[model samples]
Target: MAHRIAVAGATGQVGREIIKTLAEREFPAADVSALASGRAVGGSISFGERNLSVGAVERHDWASTDLVFLAPGTTGPVTLARKAVAAGCVVIDVTGMSDPDAPVVVPEVNPGALAANPRIVASPVAGAILLSLVLHPLQALGGLVRIVATSLQPVSGAGKDAMDELFSQTRGVFVNDTATPEQFTKPIAFNLIPHVGGFGEGGLTDEEEAIAEDTSRLLGGVAVAATCVRVPVFIGQSLSVHASFDRPIDEAEAREAIRGAPGLTLLDRRDDGGYVTPLETVGEDPVFVSRLRVDPTGPNGIALWCAGDNLRKGGALNAVQIAEELARRGALRG
Candidate 1:
């Protein structure tokens, strides 16, 4: 049941990770095409033990491709996605440019949503994925009421250039050189920016809005308030989450729930350095949960710290997992 697959935006950070994840997981792909813009067409990207010569995505023939992973930075991704769908190829959109009504899926949380064999499925933002993974298990203990989260996102979430800016700025600071902000609005080295995306109505950034919207959708009908911040770190994302449920659930009960949940690891030890950090979660799949405590402010509230590799579980790995879900459901076309 090998299927033909194409990964658009094959050169970007998340795009490359998608290809790598497909290979690492040994997806049943009869053909895998690496595609990017014209500038990256001739470049070579590794796929398993082979190197794939990149192709221009705009000129690719999608009629024969059974599936496409639409990563960010693909020029006219919205148009490209429609074209792919028209060609009868299922599209897994990671670009956030899909139809507003498209099903946003995190396989670990709401995989049943894929039973319909949808033409287009959106991979939720990394922050939302992280938030949802941790909160979903607890929802089974009691219905979720409200969620308050502040995310410390790494620069890699922005793109490769943002990572470069962080590195160069840190180097410049030690060499007595001024580090001007390029990928960011402010110097990211030794500093933090409370801004992650464009400010929208009521002063909430687009990132915050997306996280709240996606989390609520994923968790059924819970209220979510998010404040996304750009930190000086490199790879993983961290969150301080406070969640209230309909029933009073103790920290021990919540810990047991997280431990048994798939795609989640409970690492609470109540001692310094006993829990996972952003740096330690790099290149990992499961979301790491730590600092679990019962929030005293509310009757049925719990507080915790969570970290994960945004590129993997948050983006590429999640998209690849959706493709896997499709395969398992016999939804993918040959």
Candidate 2:
């Protein structure tokens, strides 16, 4: 059965990708509505061959909508999520501001976390999604004992304005025109920012804390220490992960595990240019893993590098996949 779906924040970066992903995957939608804040209500967006007129979220009829993809930057997403759930619509929140009670789901890692007839589900941060997808496959190689990862996130993860900031700042550099920091604390052109989020308890940035918390949650309570850095890249997110396991595991076994895992692509080679990079991963779905090797420093330790389109699997794609899982289970209201 085709469902009536609404994508909130449809004009923003992640939102636009969510809209595009739905159409690209040909979701079973009887009617698809593009919704945004009041200021963006008059604008338009495309869904496959059709151009959708953006509607105000306040004006959208929630009761009639069968499903809602609550994109990041959505207006009053928490309240809207509650309203949609109350209206019997299944909601997948990519905004990270959904109900704290809602389960944070990554379909490739933990589709079973969704309850039968779940009303709302939250997707983890992009770094967490990227980390989880790569690490989940390795869990079979004995239980994951400890994880230490450093995520090099792109500006796009911060939103459209940040992406613009990177572009304008870079162009300014070429023309000898210095730009002020607005979206970020410092210039992002040809520079890296170690501070991705506000400083918080234990002196860890919010982004780092979130990556650690979400990765642990998704991977069944394994200890995770994450350091998130904002890089000068545009589209993809990359991570350097060193994980320790409970038992001995070889590089070949780990490589084979990743190769067979769904939603993951292994691209490891010993040559200089044999690893996956953020540039090549743009617009791609799979989480590309490379530079896999056994860590000699510790028992049963393995290390690797992974990258992927953050806007896709990290946000929109993960939410869509959860919707697909719901559809597969016939848990949707439509």
TM-scores across all candidates? 0.99, 0.98
Compared with the true structure, all predictions reach lDDT values of 0.94, 0.91
Candidate 1, residues 1-334, lDDT tens digits: the string is: 9999999999999999999999999999999999998688999999999999999998899998999999988778889989999999999999888677889999889999998999999999999999999999999999999999999999998999999999999999989999889899999999999999999979999999999999988999799999999999999999999999999998788999999999999888877888999999999999999999999998899999999999999999999999999999999899
Which residue pairs in model 1 clash with each other? none
| TM accuracy, model 1 | 0.99
Off by over 4 Å in 1: none
lDDT of 2 by residue, 59-176 (tens): 8899999999999889998899989988889999888787877888898899888856678888899999988899898998789999999999999988889999999999999899
| Candidate 1 Cα deviation (angstroms), residue 240 | 0.4
